[model samples]
Target: MKNLNVKNFRDIKGYVNHEGLVMKARMIYRGGPLNGLSEKEKKLIEKDLNIKYILDFRDEQEAQLMPDCSFDNIVYERIGALIGSFKHQGFDFGNLLQGKMTEDKLHFLLDYIKDGYKHMAFDNPAYHRLFVLLLKNDGGVYFHCSAGKDRTGVAAFLIMMALDMNEEDAIQEYLLSNEYLKESNDTLCEQLQIPFELRKNVNLYSMFKKSLLI
Candidate 1:
């Protein structure tokens, strides 16, 4: 999971099929919102990578809030996975640090994420749409959510699974979010002026990543 010059862009590398064949590099990518890219990065994506398809997993409101930039002749598909319903509820770090909320609300939050991931991969109609896109697009396909973590990770997991990648490899790919987005997350927490302890308590990406193991 190497971070790209383009923000939050990652190559879905180091995963292998059952036959021990590594997934092709530059064929499939996952990323955060592409709207903040510079002109050079835009050309790198369009001209060099020739990324032909994008599956945007962000909800309508989130998409409107930070819409992706237009790539020349690229097909942008909005396959909202209903992750918007999993909004952030305020966290109580004092209760959490004291082990009060851990068994209750913290577990509840993690359970919600697990269920959401399962739903997105198995039951959501967007899954079928994603399949269709995969069938139609031969070139590189990039999928993203708000932070390119949970929703995008689920999409990557499902795709790797379909391509015959084993459970461990798929999970590794999913967990790469922590490594790839470390800088972005740090900047985000600093920008929001969130306390370090509270940040750890409310880290949805970390919670969600851990939940996928079970």
Candidate 2:
């Protein structure tokens, strides 16, 4: 992965697909919220990566709360995935994290997230639009959500599957966010007053793995 200094940024490349061909680099990238991108990071991506398209999956409120910086020559589209209700409304992740952070609560969260992934894969109009944009884009495409851990991660998983990547590899790529976003996740856990041990036991990777398989 090229270190572009963008927070939680990663290139979805170099993996072998089901057809036994290596995935192309610099075509697509995924990462955390670009709303707070630094001037340098913005220049780096805009100039070096030549990213022409950005598919934002954040909801209207979230987008208004912390919108991505407007860059010259880049086209951005906001198509939030359907977690519930209307197609325009985004997933209620904050509400989902409410209640005791116990093992059982963890299971419930995973179950909800798994079903959400299924919705994004098959039912979400935003994801359908993303698939079309990816196929049509001439340059690199950058896609993300607020943390780029849950919603954006699910989108990445679906893209991998669409490209005919192996199931395990696709899952592993999705799980890579555990490492790439660990620092931010830890900070968030602390801010939420969640104990380190409890956070450690959440096992989001395994939860998502099982969810996709099921």
Candidate 3:
């Protein structure tokens, strides 16, 4: 992944690197690996940013789907969604496949993400400590979920804001996941036997991208 200290995200060349690390699909975008990151990339980022801690926002199923990224001596934590007792509600195999959740229900779930952030910002003091510990103490920290676009996107936005990066740039950074994620989305759609039109419905980049940060 390029450092992305530039603009014009619509054109991949607008980004520095020209390894064809760009995609026509405009939803999920990024520059990394799903199976395993290139050591060269990892080393470059680590050396550049002094990364030390890794926060993976994925659940067990996600870990099973894509092999976890393991660094030799770095601290890794899974601060996944605060689903709490309802954590299993969406992963009961047949349940999530149905996509039976109503729009209101989905909105409520999204609200859960928002509420969690509220707690971190105001209610939970420990959240601040942990966040600072990660950003300042850790050489490099990478937070990711199943798609690394939803939960991870939120964390990335927070970090970007903390780093004093502008809000628009933060949004672009979050959108980078769209590039690397569309192919994965296509693969998942095929596995679930999703039809064409229905697959489009599941792609929520347009409808939900603006909401992930909040």
Candidate 4:
């Protein structure tokens, strides 16, 4: 079998990702502080997958944390996350979702759902622009963020809905955030010197599910 090699695939400096229906789309990466993947596997993707682009859902900090990606023919587009800083409390989504403020304090985040979450179909110009790209004859597109919950989940939900996926399917997709955040769990667990139980909040799937009216 022709093994996928990241080093070889990185020749073009494009982000390599899973190509065919060989597996489910996931949050796993080939390399990171946690369970890192091999460059060979990444090469397999570049050699076989038809990925057209990668829609990064991460904030600036998330990008800085991990920044070594290269692919052959794929494009990487960073769509600044919906999260803004919570300070000033004006319209800063970062601070609001930074473990304080309305998210847990006043809990008024839902008030902006139509603009920030549920109604994201067109509310976020960046997301919509990518959606349009996906709608075209693009090979495949993968969207992701830090935990793949909240902001990323909302984007997933809206995209699925637009794709005509049934509500059940859309809901299930959002729930995938739980598994996606495992990486964060490992890091937070050791960083906070706490058990995995306390780090359960790392699972972001439910956060998105809870925000929906359906």
Clashes of 2: 0
- Among residues 3 or more apart in sequence or in different chains, the pairs in candidate 1 whose N, CA or C atoms overlap within 3 Å are none
Task: Give the lDDT of residue 44 in candidate 2.
Answer: 80
- Which candidate has the top score in lDDT? 2
Score candidate 4 by lDDT.
0.48
Per-residue alpha-carbon lDDT of candidate 4 for residues 1-214, written as tens digits (9 for 90 to 100): 2343221111111222233122233221211111134666555554555556666655556667765366767677777656333111233344444452222433355444433554444456557756776667546665555444555566666655655556676676556545544555566546545444434443444345444664
lDDT against true structure, model 1: 0.70
lDDT of 2 by residue, 1-214 (tens): 3545556788899988878998888888888667667788788888888788888888888888878889898899998766643233346556656655777877666666666655566677777877888889588899988767667777888888888899888888888888887887787776666666777655567657666667
Q: What is the C-alpha lDDT of each candidate?
A: 0.70, 0.76, 0.48, 0.48
Task: Choose 2 or 4, whichever is better by lDDT.
Answer: 2
lDDT of 3 by residue, 20-57 (tens): 23322222222222346577644543455454655555
lDDT of 1 at 72: 78
* Prediction 1 TM-score vs. true: 0.77
Compare candidates 1 and 4 on lDDT and give the better one: 1
Looking at model 3, residue 196 earns an lDDT score of 72
List candidate 1 segments past 4 Å from native. Answer: 1-5, 83-108, 187-213
